[model samples]
Target: MDRFIWSNRGIEAGETKLFSQVGVRIYDGDQKTSYDDGNINL
Candidate 1:
């Protein structure tokens, strides 16, 4: 079990962006995925 928090501040399209993400993960085999609680596509 794990927990995380992230934040990114930068310029985007001539504007400032503050993208944040929060996630939790548990591993027990037979399962795999990506955490995207915020701007993961950015």
Candidate 2:
């Protein structure tokens, strides 16, 4: 749902490129989560 809205705005704003997400996060029975989204070079 968020992607649809973002793409609409991006198109109208002439956005032609993107550098994004590079990781995952999950929580188990231990109530622990892991996330690693590195860096955004741009």
Candidate 3:
């Protein structure tokens, strides 16, 4: 499995929401992988 850190900035409210979200893909060479959906469609 891989690890990642995602964030949602530019949100109008402090409450958690799906808008303006960003994803950081942390790759593990042992496992061949890449983003499959959403904005990070790698």
Top TM-score model: 3
lDDT (C-alpha, whole model) for all candidates: 0.44, 0.35, 0.44
Q: How close is candidate 2 to the true structure, as a TM-score?
A: 0.18
Candidate 2: tens digits of C-alpha lDDT, residues 9-37: 33335454566444534335555444233
- Candidate structures ordered by lDDT, highest first: 3, 1, 2
Error of 2 at 35 (Å): 7.1
TM-score of each: 0.17, 0.18, 0.19
Model 1: lowest-lDDT 10 consecutive positions: 33-42
Task: Candidate 2: give the clashing pairs.
Answer: none
Per-residue error for 37 in candidate 2, Å, reads 5.4
Candidate 2: regions farther than 4 A off: 1-21, 33-42
- Best-to-worst ranking by TM-score: 3, 2, 1
Regarding TM-score, does 1 or 3 come out ahead?
3
RMSD of 2: 8.4
Q: Which 10-residue window of candidate 2 scores lowest in summed lDDT?
A: 1-10
Kindly state the number of residue pairs that clash in model 2: 0
What pairs collide in candidate 3? none
Candidate 2 achieves a global lDDT of 0.35
C-alpha lDDT (0 to 100) for residue 35 of candidate 1: 39
In candidate 1, list every pair of residues with a backbone clash: none
Tens digits of per-residue lDDT for model 1, 1-42: 244334464545765535634464433365654633334412
